[model samples]
Target: MMMKNVSLLLFLIFATSLSFAQTDTLKVKTDTGNVKKDRKKVEFGPGKTHYAYAYFNFMFATPPEEGTDADIFYGKSHSISYGVRYRLKLAKFFAVGAGVNYTYYAWHFKQNDNKKIPTSIIYDKEKLKINALEADVFFRFNFGKNKKSPVGNYIDIGGYGDRNFSTKRQFTNYINDGNTTGYSDYTGINTGLNYMNDINYGAEFRAGYGSMLLFAKYRLSDMFTPEFKNEISSTELPRLMIGFEIGFHK
Candidate 1:
């Protein structure tokens, strides 16, 4: 009886030790840092991506209607853009960036009068210009790291707000009167910005190589909420822009 009792006690001790030694495979937690750090801290100096840049943009507007081409955003997108921004890299794959940007967009159009010159045609080629000052804020995602470049290859999503403070339309009529010989130029007329809305807010997306990107934007506000009468309807539509920009950016 004494030997059996001793044997039973030994067995219980062995079983308890084995239970404590066994590890649970399902529960695991890793400590990422030796100390706590603020994720919002700003970084600067060498190898940083804070920069001022200039890029030529080929930007175009989306047509308002599917079948009709007469839209506020019609024609070619010849634009000039410049900005300064600071990039805060929080991790290998994520960053937050904000900047101020200035952009100028110009478009060319022609209105023809068939009745003005039946034998030959007369048309007014008008140039429209809009100047905007904007602020851009975005989050950037880097797919991987590249030590060769200051700015990584990234995808950016952001919001932008701009004041289209100035607008003008200038046109010169060209008369191709085969009756009168060649062509004649008329005095140019300049129109004001009163027809356009003063403010615009939009969403933007960009993807590209380091320092160069393809970009697009959709404006949430209407281009014109008429303050005047026109030949057509008083309401103007919201707009979209698509462009490419090359940046000396971080």
Candidate 2:
């Protein structure tokens, strides 16, 4: 009977130990899952935070020709873009970001001089420029099975507001008779008043692989303001841009 009792006691002890061991194992797994669920951002590496970035871009616009008057012609040249952003990792795979940018827009045009007499006016050959300060807000998404890959892919979709602060035109024109009496000069014109809207709002999309990106922007607002519509009777179309963006993040 004592042997029987000893065997029973040993069995109970073994069972209790096994039960505690199983509980500990389950607890460990639960803790690990919690860690993954609560993680806010992708761990790129030590000191490689993705919350901030800077980029330089060269772009071109599809000039709007509709609002142009009978005498004004619009064409595009080169555009330079540079910006910096700050982002908040709201989830493991997503963030909301905002930043400021500067864009210099260059254009070429054949314009009829507004101030010159129509009878004497030949077309004015002009180089035009508008520069602005802009602000953007976006939601960025990160993807791919290999998050550690230095070359990766992501997407950013956002809206931007651009306020043109400067505008100028350099022109050369001869008489309508195609004679040799031509004049060339530089003039600072109010681009916002005569050609472009003072305020432009647009939608932007960027898809990136590594440090390179393809971007497209579409202006939702009219190219010219209400007051300027009468001046540029044919200039009411929206502007668009598609180009590449390259830079780095810190």
Candidate 3:
């Protein structure tokens, strides 16, 4: 009976040890899995922090003409603009951005039929240019739930108050006189006002790893100059512009 009791006691001790060992193994495995899950979460987060970026834009208006040959008369129309943007996080899905942009416009007009023109023609005998400059402060709205976008897309809307400060406006006029000559010394005048302020509204779509941006703007002011001639009248037209911006931002 004593031997039987001893054997029974030993058996109970062994079973208890086995049970404790199994519980310890399970606890260790659970802790290891939790640690691995935590590491993975730390390695890959939703997005990145907000950043300040310096931006530049070269914009061109759509050619007013349809025919390919007509494009030659319109000349090279382009604008160079540069600015800096500050992004302030207002919420998880929204941010406020303000920036300053300085823009320059280059308008060129070239002569097509030189041989059919007169030397005395008071029109553009050579290439002429108009330079327009503007300083603007803008507010931008960003679209996306996350700041760091894996899908790589954003939309921005902004407005700028701009001033055109230059002394000359470029001009080119075809000689209306009914004459034909191979050469003419007359060309268009570069005439500009002292200071003209205008307001512009624009929107931009950005994507492609920060290399592509499509933008459009409309100036709500009538770009006009007072005519010195008594018979001349004031000009009125809404300046419409649209272009693509291709560059990088860091």
Candidate 4:
């Protein structure tokens, strides 16, 4: 009877150990399955993440076909714009974004004897510029087989509104006397100008490939107010802008 009782106790111990081993193996499998499910839920792709980017543009103006009052030096007149944009992907091929930028536009006038000069001021070198804050919203459409990144070919259509905070005119001229020759520089800045429009609106389009783009903008509103339209040669500045853009993304 003692031998039988010892054998029974040994059998009970072996059974308990086998049961615990099976329970541990099942727990491990269950945990691994959960991990895989979590990974599937968090996969990175288009329409799955928010994208942030920085962009810069080099711009040129297009004067009117008939005639323009502002005859600028094409090589010296340009625009500088830098801004941050926030994009929300709505679908695999579609997204929308908005941005705010600080933009500066400079137009250097030509002082040649043959060219018609602006009647507002006379100088050897003159520059008209404006400092503005711009806000824009756009829709983006992506193309190609890659959907895992936003750094692919795309097109954007947008509209922008600008608030011109500062308008400035800078003049430089060479002065000569019998004994000496010197340069004279004068700069005038005004936050509120009677001839300039404080608010402006425009339409913009962009075609991009791998973080680089070509853009064009057309101003629907005049740069000068109607009341002061005739003050500067009865004409307006250029209404079209063509440019290239570079985008920075992670």
Candidate 5:
């Protein structure tokens, strides 16, 4: 009986020790000082929960829409657009962001009509307008070991969709024969031809000064709309945008 009691007590002690020695799978709550010293591992917050930033940027445009045979006489030029981006980081270096952009330009056409000339056709534009809306989703890769500034120098690459919300095509005609009569036609080009989806890639440099922050990125992508091809010219595969990006996040 004594031996059996001793055996039972030993078994209980063994079981308790094993339970205490088991490795914990749950993350133990930690303060700043309790954080691991490794800098390679990405850390979201010492105790905080979220990260966000606001950015303002400008993009240079390139032609992605090519003109048909009727569009040869139509001339188009490069334009610039500006917008604001709101970013939310869901993980260490992954973020989802959105932006709104607007751009417009007018094209001028010139042609001569003469009875002496073999071709009596002319093409000209009185006014044209192009407007767009863009949204982006990107993943940011961070560099350096600064917690407050987790993003020292990083690359922001993602994909975006651009939609043309409004487009206007206008033309003016003058009658050279018979009675003195002239007319102008204003067409609302509501064709669904104002949408673009492309992959975006860019790099950013970040720095902080006192209370002000400085940041910049060089972004480039390909934007094309076939329905509005007559309104634009096709020259290249990708459009280039080089401008300063300024933003702050906490």
Candidate 6:
């Protein structure tokens, strides 16, 4: 009876030790696997990622080679645009992006022999302003070595479509009768021009380093409606624009 009791006690001790050893080994493996997964989650690269950014551009319109009806003062004719974009990096060197932009164009006209050009009334300072909302898509090509972040040199080739929401004509002139040496100024503003086109499309090109870029655009559509082309001057506004852009990102 004493020998059988001793043998039973030894058997229980052996089973308990075996169970504890197996539990400890499993715990160690699980902890090691969790550490490896955490390290992988924190690693960053410039592929298969998406980000959003905002940009602002200052643009200048190039002179047209057409008739005098579209002649404008080079320094005063300018455009300002701002937009936000989202980009998807498909590979280490390629990306696709889309954006929405708002652009304001001001064309200052010079005095011409024909007073009916752009507007019926002629003034010392005449400006034709247009407000537009634009949607654009582009493909980007990155250069140089890849880094942890997406800041690098890149070039973009794209196209854009615009909706002209507002069109206006503004004029200002100095008025002075034989009265005093001080002269009074006269200003007038007209809105909703029927001659203007409501839709416009263009091709865009951009080159940049980090957050700064230079851009050029060429309009592929006409600037005036069919009625204006038939009755009024058939001349079109400047189609080329050159600008510089600054981007914001994290």
Number of the top-ranking candidate, with TM-score as the measure: 6
lDDT by residue (tens digit), candidate 1, 45-118: 22443334454455676655322223332656356777776667777678788888788877654344322111
Structural similarity to truth (TM-score) of each candidate: 0.66, 0.64, 0.52, 0.74, 0.40, 0.80
Rate residue 103 of model 6 by lDDT. 95
CA lDDT for candidate 4: 0.78
Candidate 1's C-alpha runs over 4 A off are: 1-42, 45-56, 62-75, 110-122, 176-181, 228-231, 234-238
In model 1, the worst 10-residue window by lDDT is 113-122
Count clashing residue pairs per candidate. 1, 6, 8, 0, 0, 0
Q: Mind giving the per-residue lDDT tens digits that candidate 6 earns over 57-120? A: 9989887735556568887789999999888888878989999999999988887766456865
Q: Give lDDT tens digits, candidate 3, residues 1-250.
A: 9999999999999999999999999999999999999876654322333555666776665544322221223325666787766655555555555666677765444445322111123335333233344444444444544445432445556565556545344445454465576444444444444323233333443332344677776655444333311123233222445666643453
Q: What is the lDDT of residue 3 in candidate 4?
A: 100
Q: Which tens-of-lDDT digit does each residue in 1-250 have in candidate 2?
A: 9999999999999999999999999999999888886563554421234467788888776655443342233335667889987767666667778989999977665445432211123444555577889999999887774454453567999999998888665556444454475544433343433555678888999997767889898888875556556543545433677889985753
Once superposed on the true structure, which residue ranges of model 6 sit more than 4 Å away at CA? 1-48, 146-149, 177-181
Cand. 3 TM to true fold: 0.52
User: Residue 78: error of model 6 in Å?
Assistant: 1.1
Angstrom error of the Cα, residue 37, model 4: value is: 14
Angstrom error of the Cα, residue 94, model 1: value is 1.4
Candidate 1 has a TM-score of 0.66
Residue 124 local lDDT, model 4: 74
Whole-model lDDT values for every prediction: 0.64, 0.68, 0.50, 0.78, 0.43, 0.85
86, model 5: CA deviation in Å? 5.0
Model 2 — TM-score against the truth? Answer: 0.64
Best-to-worst order by lDDT is: 6, 4, 2, 1, 3, 5
The predicted structure with the larger TM-score, 3 or 6, is: 6
Question: Which runs in model 3 stand beyond 4 Å of their true positions?
Answer: 1-50, 63-75, 109-122, 125-151, 170-209, 226-238
Q: Candidate 2 — what's its lDDT?
A: 0.68
